[model samples]
Each structure stands twice: as structure tokens, then as C-alpha cells.
Target: MSDASLNPTATDRWMLPEGIEEVLPPGAWQLESLRRRLLDVYQRWGYQLIVPPLAEFLDSLLTGVGHDLDLKTFKLTDQLSGKMMGIRADMTPQAARIDARQPGNGIRRYCYIGSTLLTRPKGVNGSRAPVQVGCELFGSDALAADAEVVCLMLHSLEACGVPATHLELGHMGVYRALLARTGISEAETVALFEALKRRSIPDVDHLSASLPENERELIRALPRLSGGLDVIGKARALLDHADLTAALDALEQVAQCVQKDFPDVDIHIDLGELRGYTYHTGLTFSAYRSGMGSALAHGGRYDGVGASFGRPRPATGFSLDLRALLPLIQAQATPPLAVLAPAEGGEALEAAIRELRRTRPVIRRMPGDALEDYSDSCDAMLTCKDGVWRPEPFSNRS
Candidate 1:
């Protein structure tokens, strides 16, 4: 009946919006573990990790990313300098900006694991505040370079214990070459690309109606060129234009190379999978799991995008959504160690706990605490008595 009665203080006060979240306790540990595992894989492959700042100037960030992303970035003005700054919605552009600023003599390999914030519709099911783990390779344009990135991604997923994942590959060059033959306007090309992304045959047909008859036929065939290894042969036949055929050939070569190294890996060719930042001038791909509705990792070649920033390097990489993989990893995780401590001897117990932590994660539970009463929750416990460590057997029942 009254405002205060209907809405309490917590409900009435303005707070941070829904999409953003606070990482706490176990979630923080899982986040750090995922980052560590991913970074280890990157380092083994010669990618040095780089941490770009959270805030960057608007112009630098939006250079290669399209208008849609620019609209989503969180904008703010510097308090002292009064310059417009934005919280980065993605990390790849920031890496590009960093590479442009600091020129390397030859090729550069970089990796990062960082948090990214994005605005999503209310009640979105998955995490909007994501932790992105990615690697970027610069100054190589060979199809072999693209295949290397794909292989590294597969290895990283395996290290993280993800099972039965498939890599869906596509060549943006093929689609762009077909578009070039049409002599269509930029607006028509963008419209047709968007239609292909959505896999809407009717929309693609309607959008290509104004183009030449030959162009329309090629555009209509895009949605059909997605499947297993056999799809590559179909694409080579269906795509008659020389440039398109050449691009498809390059993709086939890369696929064959990857299979040679990883004979059991599942690979798919999808000509209609057109999602990438505007900078990706060549190949693009995404990794998907069986039950996961969305891609767990996605990236592509951005040879020209780096050039826009004065670097003039060819690069490609993939970003894995660490947050999405957490649940699956947790389901298979080994239980952590729980150490019981004496209330009066916290200092000595803490010292021993620190030693134990080097080998395994330790959760401290004090004597006379409910955790001590219920030993079943812990793997094992160390009781502190007279400055000595006494290992105790954990009972199955409290």
C-alpha cells in the first residue's frame, strides 16, 4: 500500500546494471585457474602474454571494429585530461594498438587473459561479464600460419579437458572474391553478408535480386556450402569464379594439413559462417562443443586491419570464453583439500597451511568449528597440536 512497504531499501536503491557482475570466492579461483592453464599453453607455443589497460581512447579501439561494437563500448571522460575514453568490449583491437605502438623487427606472438564487459538483454542465460583467453600472431599471411593457430587452439582445449569439440572453418576471401565479381555496391555486399550470417535463404535471395543473374546464383549457393570434409570438394565445384576457387583451395589445403597432424580432430567447412571483425581479410573459424549452442572460441585473419594502424602485419588468433568452459571443467574437477586448524594456534597452523598450498589448494577449518565436526566434506585434515602436524583420517560420517 505504501512505497516503503512495497519496496525495501535494497530494492529501491540504484545499483550496477544487470549484465555486469562481481566475481567472488570460488568463481575467482576458477577464473584464475582457467587463465593459468590457458597461459601455460600459450607460453609453451612461444606466445608472450601482454596486459593492455582496461581503458583506451575511443578512436583507436573503434578503428577496425565495426559501428555495432562502437555503440556497445562503455564511454567515459578522463577526469584530469577531459579526453574521451572507453572500456574495451574486446581485447584483440587493444593488442593491435599495442603492436602498432611498439614495432617488432620480425613476427610477434602475443597472448592475454582478461575480463571483458558487454551489454546484453535482461535475463540473458550465459555470462555477460566474460574472461577472454586469447593469442595473437602477427606478420604471417601463409595458410600454414592459420592452421597453426587452429592446432594451438585445439591443444589448449584439450589441456583444459574439453571433449569432442569441432572446428568450423571458412575463408572470408572466398566470399569477398565472389562479391567482387558481382560489381555490387558496398551496401549490397554488407546486406548479403548479414543474410548469410543468419543462414536465411529467403533473405539472401531477396537481397541478391538486384544483382546480376550469375551473381545471384553464387550468392544463393553460400548457405549450401557447409558440412564435413566432403563439403570442400562441393565448394570447389559450386564456386566457379577463379578467385573464389583459389580461396577455397587454400582453405582445403589448410584443412588437410591440420588433419595430417591431428588425425582424430573433427573439422568442418562452412562457407556461410561469416562472423568476424571487419579487419579479417582472409580465413575465419569458430570452435563449438556438442551441447553448447554458441561458439566457445572464434577468431580469424586480420591482415589489413593491422595495416590501418600503421603496423602492416598479417595476424590471426582465437579467444576462448573461459567463463563458458568453467562449468564443464568443474564437473570433472578433483575435490580440494581441507585443512583443520586449532583456534589458539592459528599462526603455526597458518605456516603449515602455506606449505601445503604449494602442492594443493587448502581450505582452513578451525577446531570447534562445524567443518571440523563434519569431516566428510574434506579430503583430509591436519590437526595442530603442540607445534606439530598430525595427519587425521577423515570419517565418511560426521
Candidate 2:
């Protein structure tokens, strides 16, 4: 229907759209291997794997807690039903739908690894499509659920070969409780939230200027509350309200539990840092390494996401982009010893090829395909010597 489709040129054939990429050679291999390993790790932790449809009704995709995801989603009209549909920008809401549909009231843990499409790139030179790998826990309000997910996230990073990572923890309850006490209107609260997210102290001062000086000082103090665990003490000293005090107590409890469980991970607290303020109800956290500008993986306790699906359950989870993680992973290039067998080989060579494949990979040499075709893929070649087929290094082949 289009001119480019009818008569494609060399430029069309070779080029790809910006923010999209193809994982070639070793990168593809590493992605697949990492995906499998992470999924396996999640399964061992009692999380069942589920695959939700890639595209669904727009309303269904946007149902609960997706204001951020909504802007990133790609939308289209379904021809058969003539209804709006959306490609998922994140899979957490879908996982929530699945959990809500489950038969009983017992706890449910779900894990998923799949590709998600976004309208915009997540970071500098990021892909529009990222392989999302994550797990969600539902039906538990205990701090242990938050602790479990955080520990699992740490194990996940360790499994992916990330080195010497740190954890930054925050509780949206702190800010939400403080805001509720301020008695500010919704519009002003949202404006203040955006400013705080940007860590713009001047804008916070400008926006909260109308509030009473006491309320304004508390709002202004939020962005300054980032550091090691002692920051919690400062937060408690600054806020005296009973509900706000309770929220700080919850933060202290969760942070202590996580520290006890994982003593090696360095923990930082940001009482004012409300990353998922609208959705996340309680303890929120993200993992970081040395060079990444953004978090490696992030999630938090979103207690009411299931309410939109007719079931209100406590939920928390985290997701990481597998494609983005490939660069962060300190992977050792242990390329498999692939044996290339000639097409003309008889049943003996075929049998040998099958047997070798069981131990290592085997690349079949197709008819009319040159040796160079298999050069980079295989390090060794199968040869016949005195009626016995054997594999020798490609460099040593005569």
C-alpha cells in the first residue's frame, strides 16, 4: 500500500528505525542465555511464569496505575472489533489482572519475561522495545513481601553478573501522609510532586509558597532527605504527626529487615523521593550500579492496583530491561565449541554430529555454503580420518 513497500531501496533494506536494534552474533546469544537464567531463578523462588497477550483492549491495558506507562504505549485500532487497542508498555498491570482472576484468596506469585514496545525510548540510545523480566507478589501486606521481592531483585542482579550494586529505598507513604496533612488541593499536590521528582528545590519553594509556613517547610524538606539510613532519624525529627510518624516507623522496619537479610548491599534512604507516588503505597526501592544513569531495576508496594480489576490486593514487583542489562552484565565470553560438519557426510558423520551436539552446539555445513559462512560461528570442523570422523580446530584443518 506504500511506495517504500512496493519498491524498497538499499537504504530501506539496511537501515532500522531509531531506538530499535537487532541483537546480532554474541549479543543475541547472551540475551537468550540471560533470559533463561533469570526466569529459572524466579521459578526456583516459587514464582510461576505467565505470558499475557502482547496487545489488548486499550482500556484493559490502561486500567490501573499506568499514567506513566500510558504516554509510552503504542495504540492502534483493531480491525475486526473496530476498537482501540494498546501494545503494553509494562506488564505489571496485566499480571495484576491475572492475579485478580485467580480462583481463590491465597497468595499468588507470578513471573514473566517478554518483549514490550514503548512509544518513546527510556534512556539515552535506549530501545523502543525492551525484553522485560520481572516478578510480582500479591495478597500479602507484610513487610516480608517487600523484603522478598527486594532480595529476589538482588539475586537477579547477581545472577546477571552485575557487580557491587547498591539499593536506594523510599516510602511513598511518607510523602502521601505529609501531603494529606497539608490540606492542599489535588492540583497543587500534583505540581509539588512533579517538582520534587525533579529534585528542583527552587521550584518546590515556588510552588509550596501558598501553604502555611509549617506545611511549606515540611514539603521543602523532602528533597533534602537523601543519604544513608541515618536520614530516617532526621525525617522523624522533622515530622511530628501521628500518621506521618507511623509511616516513618514502617520505613525503618522494612529497611532494617532488608539490611538484616542482605548485609552486603549498601542501603540509602530518600524519604522525600517519591518515584511512584501515584501507584506505590509503601516501601519503594531501586537498585543501582556504578555507571548507569537510571536505576537497574525498580518496584514498590502498590497495595490497591487489583482494585481496578474488582479485587483489591496488596501487590509489589520489579522489572528490568534485559536488553539494557546486557551491557551492564560482566559476562564471560565462553562461546560454545561448535562443530561444522560437511553436507556430503554419510550416516556416520550425521551420527557423530548428533552425538557432538548433545555436548556442544553443531553447525551443519549446507550445500553451496562456503567455509567462511561458518567461520565465526564454529571454532572447529568435523573431518574423516581412516573411517573415523573427528573434530579438529578450524585453524589446524589442512
Candidate 3:
């Protein structure tokens, strides 16, 4: 063969950019089925479904969490408005916007399922474009709101077939309260938050060195306060500021409610976990399971996220990557059924095909085509017998 024939052209390569993936065949079906089931459950729970545009003005998209979201979002200049726009990196903020618009003093529940694009991959196995499915509860400051959101997060995982999951709970309020009492600079607090989030003891100690002995000790101790139920007691004893006390109490209340409702769920506490530090106001939690390195779902309370939209409301919610959870799900296989029809058939055969499709997936085979052409896709074939078309199992016995 000539060199031209051997070498692959750009189009011939047919390669996708890194971090993007296409779901084919049965995998696509599985993801869609899981999405439908999740939305169905959310609907039953009174979460009205909302579909936000994939892109929005950067100002609205970034809203309160601009610092955290800027790096992850994809920006573009809108042709229509000549203004900056962003493809969403996360959908939680959009859900918050929708909730802000609802006219009610009572709680509003909203759920959404859509694709979010990121500028970079979240982790080694993470996808840049993830199908983000989540629900948000608005207008409640009660601890019960936090518990309900956490419970819904756990149930979502269970519905997706995650096994032996454990919830790691934390309160950003604890750490935030400590920072407030320290009277630290904004830059210093940001540095401390990063250190505690990574659980870097050396960094935490270095940053807190300039503070007073009591303040320094408390700052250093934040990252180490993590464990089971006992961690709450440790937090209460180690931190004594009024805000800190309130935070610990709120966390304990949420823990009690979650434990009472979900007895089987293994719960662990990490007082240092500042996952959504910039955005989360109070309690935060993440659910992790065996065989997965990352949390299956995560969310927390962000009390003032909707302020920019002109209607501030306390909100709590969780989101999971639907495509990521597909492998963990033990779903049944769906095979296509092929119905063979004559090249020139009457309207009766067409009617029969439609009827069969109602119960099971049915595909029509053209006349004079070899059965082998339909062998791979068709699990069963329909043939006319006694003047009526009946489905007969098609087994490719080669």
C-alpha cells in the first residue's frame, strides 16, 4: 500500500478530545433508564423538574461562587448579545436561580438532569462533560432541611445500585466560625481553608503560627477533628466560641436526624472537610462507597446563594454524576427484537409491528435480506403464521 493509504488523515482518525466520552448502544440505554428512574422518584417526592439552558451569561452563572467556578467554566462571547457567556460547570447554581424566582414563603423543591461541561477533568477517571442530576430545597433554615437533603442523596445512590456506602459529614460553619473568632485576614482565611481541605498538618501549623496561642491551637486542631459520633464531642470541647458552639450544635442535630432516619447507613464525621468552603454556609456531607475513590454524591447548605438573583433563599441539595454511577449499577440487559416483514406487505403487518413495540422493542427487517444482516441486533423475529404475525425467538446458531 502507498504511504497515503497507510497514513490516517485528521478526519480518518475519528478521535475525540480528551475527557469527553460517547455512550454507545446498551450503555446509552442504561444511562437513560437510570435518569428516568431518578427523575420519577424525585417527582414522587414533589420535586418539580426544571431544564435550564446549557449556557448563560457569565455574570449570572458565576453569581456568588465566581472565585471557585471561574477556573472550571468554559467562556464564550455570545453572538446575539456581544456579552460573555459560560457553559455551566455545575448545575446547582442554576437550580438556585430557578428556586429564587418561585413566589412563595414556603419551601420549594426543584430537580434537574442535564449535561455540564468543564474546562478540565475533575480527576483521573472523571469526565469533562458529566450528566449532572440533582435536587435543591429552598426557603428553609431548619436542620430538618439539611437532613432531608442528605437522606435524599443517600436514597439516590441506593437507587443507582451503590453498595455499602458510608456518609462523611462535616460543617463548614465550624471552621468558618473559628476563622471569624480569630479575626484573620481574608487572604489568611483562604489559605487556612485550603490547608484544612487538603488535611495538610504542616501547612495548617505554618499558617496559624502568627496567631495567639489559643487561636493557633484551635486552628491547627480543625483538620484533626474527624471520626464517628465522637468527633462532635471533641469539636464541642475543643472549640468554645459562640458561633463555633452553634455550628457544632447544628451539626449534631443533623447527625441525629440522619442517624434516626437511616439506621443502616454508616456515618463518619470529618469536621475539617470544607468541600464547598467558598459556597457552603453550614453543614456539608459527601457519600462514598466501596470500590469508588470519589464521593458518589455531595451537597450542603448554601444559605445566600440566591442573593444575586434578587431573591435570597437558604438552599441545600446534592448532585451525582449519572454516567459515573452507571458501572456501579447492576441493571438488566435490553436486547432489540427484530420483526421480519415481507418486501410488499399490507397495512396489517405494519399494525402488528406497532402493537409489538408497545410491549417490547421491535425492529423491522426488509424483505430478501439475509437473516445474518439482522442477527446481531435482533434477539427475536416475528413471522406470519395462520395469517397472523407472531414473534418467534431468533437465536443465531452459527
Score every model by TM-score: 0.89, 0.92, 0.90
TM-score of 3: 0.90
lDDT of each: 0.77, 0.86, 0.84
- Please provide, for model 2 over 106-223, each residue's C-alpha lDDT reduced to its tens digit, 9 standing for 90 to 100: 8999999998998999777779999999999999988889889988988898888874368999988888877887898888888999999999999999999988898889989999
Stretches of candidate 2 exceeding 4 Å from the true structure: 1-8, 330-334, 396-398
lDDT of 3 by residue, 234-318 (tens): 8888888888888888888888888886887788989888887888998898998866678888899999898998888888898
What are the root-mean-square deviations of the candidates from the true structure over C-alphas?
3.2, 2.6, 3.3
Count of backbone collisions within predicted model 1: 0
lDDT of 2 at 204: 97
Candidate 1 vs candidate 2, TM-score winner: 2
* Global local distance difference test of model 3: 0.84
lDDT-superior candidate, 1 or 3: 3
- Candidates sorted by lDDT, best first: 2, 3, 1
lDDT winner among the candidates?
2
* Candidate 1 residue-wise lDDT, 1-398, digit = tens: 99887776875565656666666656667667778888888898999989988888888877877877777688899897888988877899888877777757477889998887765521347666777788888878888789889888877788788843688888888778877788887787788788888999999999999888877888898899889989888877777777887788888888888788778768989887777636578888887788777777788888856666876778888888787787787788854546554455566676877787777656665555675464544666677567676656565435
Candidate 1 clashing pairs, residues 3+ apart or interchain:
none
Best by TM-score: 2
Clashing pairs in 2: none
